[model samples]
Target: MKVKFFFRKKEPQFNSIEELFDAVSRKLSVIISVESITMPYGKISFKNIFKNIKYTRANSGKLNHITGHINYVTLGLKGKTILTIHDVGSTLNGNKIKFFLMKVFWYWIPALSVKKITVISEFSKKELVSIIPFAKDKIKVVYNPVKEELKYQPKEFNASCPKILLIGTKSNKNLENTIESLKEISCELHIIGKLAKEQLLLLEKLEINYFNQFFISYEEIIDAYQNCDLLCFASTYEGFGMPIIEAQAIGRPVITSNMGAMKEVAGESACLVDPNSISSIKEGVEKLIDDAEYRTNIIHLGLKNVERFKIDKITNDYLNIYKEVIEAK
Candidate 1:
């Protein structure tokens, strides 16, 4: 019954997949290996450090160096080893040699040793196959789970500012297009997480108001989603878009880029827009804010959309995968 759970250790906040793992770790016979590098917080940020991307460089080089997995394998005589591969971005689109080398090197090392691999989205599963096709049969698309309370409350809206919530890191997320889109859309753009100084300067030029994204408790997030008109995700690419699902769970209409797994996660529930097109984003925002029929419809659809991605369902999938691996061994 012993099993090992492995994840990137230095992520400042526990990732959603890891949170689910922690919630049931004690009940399930599992050990975890966390990558001790602070890559999540220090390197990938919304903060606009235009030059001297030191943290990103360090992250590129050291993102997947989970130093102790060999030890986990050596010690686990009777346990199944389950690896969660959140995304394959570093390997596929880091768009640099150092990043490519590190990600490519570390990506397959775990699959070779672990008994099973849990991917967050099929988008990531496809990429993992592209990296090392041998692991395709072993990789399972276990969607990331959300807390029950985030969107469990009744509907609430703030007509004051008409907020369009865009949450993501500044560098990779298409903040530039979001800012451009804001010029046409009158609503206040609420961005979550830090942005670089250059991004601040640009937003200032666009005459768009932005608040530094603060960390909110689960209740607060639910409240925010309940209040907003649309949960706008302008991310260029994601392995799996968690915020979109979280927003949908809270019964808010989502206006996210049709890129990556967002469309798959949102299905027909969200209004898909082009992340690169400011005009398209502007149009999507306007539809949500001005058209009541559209907003209410998507909200209902979003609630239904989130049902497919329930945490418990994903967890059960993982449990089955673990059982299969253990039985095969």
Candidate 2:
């Protein structure tokens, strides 16, 4: 039986999901669905990149029924389907009324009707059960696995002025608070991903100097990790913090929130802060900036903590879930 992966690209171009699929497939026949946001790329490229197994393309957005239909077709009609739910925080993170109403339409309806559920973090699994308890037994926790080979050499720390890398699109990243933190410090701040209109407006109002970086490759991200003194995650919420692990793997200390699965992944390796408070984020960075010995300690803990998440281990977790679905069928 063939396995189909459903992925929607919110951004114009990126291969985060594709890279994850590459780590999971070997002897199995794989199918990929791209959620094309910009100009549509050829579906054949996905097949070629994925060893010409099978692939397709579709428009992005709330298409739960359409997504289920696509999986049914790709899985040979009678084949069991495994659906991966990335995050439910968008529903819960914002306005309560909007979040509540959206879940009735975008989340619990056609979305929970899957043969199997793969979640990236325990935090997400908890959120899923809270929102849609019917999907609990079918849910499986599989952390996003990043290959170790992608890691590049880290640059030597420059003690002059620290460089803080804030990664994420302008929307939902809480950049206004981040900019407030920047004002308190003298370090150069680098921002990544596309900006939402409100974020741009906030940046203009703050009058802070920031670089809008467009990344063409993972190497660009790696470069940011290498050069930066700290990776300021500063996100209000996430299912699993991918960059936290990536930065730890690359020997950079992370400043992330203590809420949700962020703390689960970061543990004691990262300096936890109240993401709502710009003062808290500023204080965390100052400790790292002023204390040389503290930086060494955190980096050492980070190196050790990163080893806990091997890509192969997580891949095996996915394999076990796949086997369960097949056996049940």
* Model number with the top lDDT: 2
Model 1, 1-329: lDDT tens digits are: 43433333334343454455554443333333232222232242234222212342343221122222122221222334556666767445454785665444456655665566777788888887887787777777778776655645445555445777777654657888888888755667777666778778888898886665555544555566776667888678887888888888877778888878877787788889998888998888878877788888888888887888776676577667756765783
The TM-scores, one per candidate, come to 0.79, 0.78
Cand. 2 Cα-lDDT? 0.66
Clashing pairs in 1: 9-35, 46-170, 46-195, 46-196, 47-195, 47-196, 48-195, 48-196, 193-213
Query: lDDT, candidate 2, residue 26?
Result: 36
What is the per-residue lDDT of model 2 for residues 1-329, given as tens digits with 9 covering 90 to 100? 33444543224355566556555553222332222222222343434423211333232222211221122222222235566766776645568787876676455653445566677889999988887787688777888776665463566676677788888874557777888887757777778787778777877776766777764577677777877878888788787888888888888888888788889888999988888998998888888888888887888788888777787677667667666766773
| Runs off by more than 4 Å, candidate 1 | 10-14, 23-79, 91-100, 156-160, 215-220
The candidate maximizing TM-score is 1
Worst 10 residues of 1 by lDDT: 62-71
Q: Per-candidate RMSD vs. true structure?
A: 7.4, 6.8
Residue-pair clashes, model 1:
9
